[model samples]
Target: MKDGQEYLLFLTPEQDGLFGTRGVTFGKVPLNTEELEVSEDQIESSHTHTEKLRTIFNEGRKKYGK
Candidate 1:
């Protein structure tokens, strides 16, 4: 993700109870259309590893982006 940009992230805690943002690049999604920078584009363009997140993003956009 880029600095200062908002994202819809899927976070989970490790065995130590500390949250990990490690999959930001693979599962996280940008919150705004304007925030679809290179990384975000890359994410949408390739869904081999992120089909669920992509589906969520699409459903959200269709439902909320009126």
Candidate 2:
């Protein structure tokens, strides 16, 4: 991918508090036409993850009142 180009990533959380790609061979999909077309399920999963993350963040903010 080009240096400035954006990409879509599908990741799973790791035990060490880091995220890694869902699969070793399925990492770093570009946000281009063909990639997007082939990744409908992944796109949906990304959206779900986004919502879950938002919820987690909001709960943390409330708990800490930060």
Candidate 3:
């Protein structure tokens, strides 16, 4: 996805959570674009991870206050 373009990302099982204003770099994975399928389920999952990240960061800020 292009920068400044809104996008939802579903992290793999290994990923902890979503990115707030920060960005992430994924490993290079070759795939067939023709078989790509994006669904509401994936979007929701991404949203969930984003929320989780937000919560975690909030808690950290509370603790550090810096």
Candidates in order have lDDT scores of 0.58, 0.50, 0.37
Deviation (Å) of 64 in candidate 3:
0.8
Per-candidate TM equals 0.46, 0.40, 0.32
Estimate, for each residue in 1-66, the C-alpha lDDT of model 3 and write its tens digit: 434433333344444664332324221111222112333453355767656545544454445333
Model 2 misplaced regions, further than 4 Å: 33-66
- Which run of 10 residues does model 3 get worst, by summed lDDT? 27-36
Off by over 4 Å in 1: 22-26, 34-53, 60-66
lDDT: which candidate is best? 1
Model 2 agreement with the true structure over 11-36: per-residue lDDT tens digits:
89999899987753244454432322
Candidate 1 displacement at residue 24 in angstroms: 5.2
